[model samples]
Target: MSRTHATPVNAVDARLPASGRLADRAAFEAFRAAATRRWDDLWSVERMVVSVGVDSSSLAKGAVEVLAACRRELTGSDAVVREVSGNGALWMEPWVEIKRPGQPPIVYANIDPSEVPALLTGSLEERALGVRDGDAFGGIPALDDHPFFRHQERIVLRNVGVIEPESIEDAIARGAYSAYFQVLFEMSAEEAIAEVTASGLRGRGGAGFPAGIKWESGRKAKARPKFVICNSHEGEPNVYKDRRIHEGDPHRILEGILIACVVCGAERGYNYIGGEYPLAIQRFRKAVADAERLGLIGQDVLGSGKSVAFRVRTGGGAYICGEGSALMFSIMGVRGQPRTKPPRSVEEGIWKRPTIANNTETLANIPDIITRGGAWFAGIGTEGSKGTKLMTVQGPVKTMGLVEVPMGISLRTLVEDVWGGMRDGSTFKGIQTGGISAGPLRDDHLDIPVDFDSMTELGGMLGSGGFVVFDQTVCVVDFARYMTAFNRYESCSKCVPCRLGNPALVEVIDRIRLGRGSLADLALLERTSKHIIELSLCGLGQVAPMPLLGMMKMYAEEFRAHIEEGVCPTGTCPISVAPSALVAAD
Candidate 1:
């Protein structure tokens, strides 16, 4: 779309000190006191409350206006109305929770403004409290008990949808910065890095590089004024994990950044978010301001004598800006393009200084690793890939939204059990993982574990954890052409292979689809694809041929049918036909 950069506002003007709101320790004490009180006292008029967390507020059409209408209509009512952040369950929003002290929360999904009046008046019969048959328990099923939620291990998404995005108090109440505090006061920088290395935490962006090794590079580098950049430019199509995390749990990200800064000896930090994500930009900026005001990010942070300056910079909506070197260049007000490595971003980056650049989800895992210790975190997921992964499931699935599952879960379980199988009675054909860069896998590969090494072994990379399902009706050849077109558009023109090769691939696929291809064209396509893969400069160019390569290998019969038979096996492509007059003459 467009590119814009913003400097963070000074901490003083951001907001009032967080002391005015409830701290985590104080919140726990208050909860304890409220628990022992009588039911009548607990459910008093002052305690009646309702909260809404409209997921995908910005992208979900009319959701923001609907939320505003709900708030306005609830004005002057005995119940307290509060707006919260969504829990990554975009399909079930606008998710609402109505609670009275000592009673279970009454949850509702996909609520419209027209239903608010009746809901506030206690006309419960007119509204469905849950999305599915077993979703309602007593009033509404506990959020954790839902099948979609029960299978997840929410670390980065811990406070999401449960707390207000802009409220530091609400965040702390849910243990937002507890890990940061423990890391700051109890653990040494070396100790923190050791813990992370032991946890086997890898970068969640795409490349599964170890987080500890990256931090250690910055630590050992002989440089001053080291920097850490939070790579929040989530530009991948059909992936919304980073945006949802920033919108729902901004504080957790901030806390993670602070922890990274401390461990890596970074005196300055920048959260580089994409310009397309206005809501994410706004929320993260506000969160940085709030943290600064509370001494969580500025000089003399939390009275620990540690100092760091934090800022938020927006990036142009280029796909390449997601790369570390390209992102650093964007921050420096240059063209957002990738640079050759040897002196990587960790060694000499951001004005030729040592920098620890990490993705949003990677940094979000830091606080938990610090507090729980490395071995505890390592206990989850596969031996090579530890911790949970946040994935976006779309396409033909019955349920489509953001989901977090521990690493090593089979794709079959995720598609069938988590997503509830395909929609419209469709049969599964294949799945595309790691966004557009990775290859596709057929139904037989569904049983494979979704870890970094395992996915690599299956000729795919879990690049950013985007799982899109395809049904029996999909033509693999057409899908490859579409993906190649996308790669052509986003190639950055940095190298000849991606810039020139992708367009060439698209043309060949189109020729084959339109009944103009020969046996020679198939050989040419394969040769050209291999050359592009071998000669590309960046990951974008390197992975450009994956979709086409994958399709040719997995569905060679489909390609042969199009070339030899001149008909689309899946009936998705149209064939040339004789004119009506010509048919009559015949």
Candidate 2:
């Protein structure tokens, strides 16, 4: 796909004067009023609007061309064409919306530039376009009314597709920094921590650690030059929730960071994002600069007598860097490897001082937690896992995209209701939750709640809310081999068990796949898996063997058939005829 130079329509121009930047309360309100008045005008209404987000920009460049073409053709029609954040449904990219003054917005997905002229003139056939829906407000079947969105309880993703990502005015109008201001002026640092603790908010970064406890430790730790880190290095395959937030709602994240800094009494902050997410990095950089210009993140923030410095650091894209200690090491200008936990990051972190590290989603939830109060936030999800979770569903599902569902939601409901079941009427087999690190769960396990404890009880962990579905055509053995190989390759080689055992595990799985395995090989595989799990230093080494072990336990009959019959039951693996012929000859 071709890259387009699409800037946010609400982005503050660099050439503008200081007063025009709208840094203060009066200036921001003035800007909001003017923007709203312009939109509310009836005589000169902007007839058509085309908004493209990171997902669409990555998936369909043709939509950008379509937007440009529409702008040129409708120059006389007073139409507006601009880039906006995606609605989290990545499958419907290059999503276009047409709005008249009084009529509901006309939504079209996967739009191409070639269809621009016809669409503007109302001459295009709706069936030919990709996922068309109209009359959003008048009850004419809008995108939000769809099951994929209707069932979701959006908290972090509330402002994603609704506002321009770079528009601070729009974000503030929608209550972005209100929480930070509340925390700064109304509540004391201890009060803030107590509120979060009372709300039962836990970290969304797979560990399920309580956020309040971490903050309290940072606040009380006897260290100077404290720091806060936002972990956006989402290296898991097919997981893009953090990237989406960074791209679509950069200000929300910044606000959350500011709140954390205030509550933890930290003056320095770092946003450690993955190097692969160029767009997210760009947006985040702009958001920080914009916030600084507005006196929200620098010296004497909002005139509240507090100062904080923030920087953005790009990781080397190692999966292990997602670990807290490993992320800190990368920021300290060293190799991205996990460190042993004793002092922990809260007590001793970057520069041997107190630090608080949180994932992008975890930090993003802070603003809401402060604004709504901890108890209000806690009342939403299950008894243990409070609040909502942003999940990325891929693989054989009919509708593969990002979804924000409440905690304790069953996997069966998510797959059948939200995703509309598997594609091509395929039978459901299993799903790999929490990315490749977590083990796969069979169809029978679908009814189990997807909270942290429930998933852990079933030998799976919600390792950042990645749910990849598989169909009947998928072979569990082959899938296990693929996941194991990924972990082996991405291992940081910091520990002996992971560095050596991962490749050995891959070799054993390959031997079984080739119909050359025995019961003795299975015993060796189990022993090696246990050794890797117990002896490894960090999470990467410890959880590396989960997929392999899960498949061995869940699909024992399939493995037995591959060994005794020398054939793959699902026909996904190629079997050698020589093994069977040799056995017959014997």
Candidate 3:
């Protein structure tokens, strides 16, 4: 399942922007003019910035509108397209030089329709724009159509949705290789670790382990030819953040992966993206080629004389592959089953050499941290979970998409305020957050902060930020059964707990849904869940029982009603007779 194909040059310039040497102002103008001259179907060439709301959930539609407008306007005309950040929009027409990250895209300062001579005379129009502050709205005169600006403190995900896929120049334009360059040229391996440690970026791949701790351990490990693995195989359903980043911003991700290789003294790295994400595979492969052509990846990058190589490896549609150890095994051509810890991935991983495995999101942040100081990055989010998180908020929500928000915000704020409240007027039943690994949350838990520690206490951990909400009509029993069946289907048969326990749990839920369960059955199910959670070797088994346990805890009456009254309270059980059906006919 290799999607490694050499990308044709100019395909990028045709599709997105002119990369490489054309990144400069003069080259940008020359390339833009040349491309525009070749294509005669040009329409208006005015610089337009389409703002997608600051929320991650706004990305899909926001991206669609921005692209649709860009296509509608620039389809025939080869215009200079650049992205600006002042307005949360993907600026298509080159209003400002968006060659750098952290800096806002140029805004038209002191614009006067009075100066229509440039437009009337057909002369090049020049406008100066300043970096507008957040509070600029209150003080500055707000234009009727000025784009809404929203920006979060970024370190890990600086280039995610901002950059074009596979464009090394785009990544560089977003401060891509600067982190590795800094590490290679300025900072020692220890200094790099200290910077990340100070930044307080916990692993975004469900495991909230501190990134610096992982690096320190890997650095201290006594293994030569160490390895680093970029875990992009996002097995969690509903979580599209990683896939989107991989498809939309592969270069920055690779930059982070390469940084890990340098910091941990690793010789090789693998980007383990799942088979489900075909677009991601294509984009990442193209990005790799683009990076190589620009001397970003492979053999002595950036005149450091340090050789590092990488390959994009696709998994066989296994959720277990997301587990760090299993990811390493999959890269080594073995079944994607996780091994035991103690001699963790740090001490012995891919090919049994001390290895460091990080999620795509985690790797994505490295460049920004390197470009901007760690302290600058650390200022966002809570003290514990410093920096932002990419959360995929789907199901029972008006705005169902990905969002990057500062940690420590209440779940209530995210669900109600940010997501535009649940789908409709239907009262929020609960949330199935963190995917199958996480438990459910009731209304009472809304105040729970969205950081790693707070979520765990409320029966849900931040597992890849796949938060699926269910409205009032959702059946907790059916929901639990659905999750149990999912675990049963995906469970690797490497262990008896997950292999047998998952199916057995599913059967228990099915029996209860069929009105064949007793109170004792619930007790037995609880015990079974305990066994699975405690004895399972990998993350799958440990978290398979989460839905069942959480549902039982949150809505025990729902299950009891199914067993006692032979009625699914939420009217979801297939076997349950409707009130209308039970009513006597004349």
Candidate number with greatest TM-score:
2
For model 3, what is the C-alpha lDDT against the true structure? 0.68
Ranking by lDDT: 2, 1, 3
lDDT of 2 by residue, 114-165 (tens): 8777777766546222223333454346666677887888899988876678
> Which candidate, 1 or 2, would have the higher TM-score against the true structure?
2
Each model's TM-score, in the order given? 0.89, 0.90, 0.79
lDDT of 1 at 415: 88
lDDT of 1 by residue, 1-586 (tens): 0011121111111222224223344443453233223222322434445668855553374556656766677554444556677777766777667765545567677777777767766685445454221245555555666657778888888878766788675676566777777766777889999999999999999998999999998888888889999999888876889989989999888888888888888899889998888888888888887776656776666567788899899988798899888899999999988888878887899999999999899999888898888998899999889999998887878767788889999888888878778888788888888888788888888899988888776677788998788888888878888888888888888888888998899888878877788989889998999889999888778888887887788789999998999988887654433222111000
Please list all clashing residue pairs in model 1, or write none if there are none: 3-316
Query: 84, model 2: CA deviation in Å?
Result: 0.7
* Model 3 C-alpha lDDT per residue in residues 1-586, reported as the tens digit of each score: 1112122123234444444532223443444444444232111222222221112223322533443343344343323343322122222222222111232333332222333234223232244233333222313322222322132333444554455454455555555566776777778999888889888988998878899999899888887879889898888766777877776567778888888988888888889989987767887898888766655566766566677888889999888888888888888999988888878888889888899999888888887777776897799888788888887676767644456778887788777766657655777889988877878998889998898888787678787888888888888988888888878888878999989997888888777877788889899899999999999998767888987898898898888899888888878776575433422111
Q: Where does model 3 exceed 4 Å of error?
A: 1-157, 577-586
Comparing 2 with 3 on TM-score, the higher-scoring candidate is 2
Each candidate's clash count? 1, 2, 9
Clashing pairs in 3: 41-76, 42-76, 42-77, 50-89, 51-89, 56-402, 56-403, 57-402, 156-365
C-alpha lDDT (0 to 100) for residue 440 of candidate 1: 83
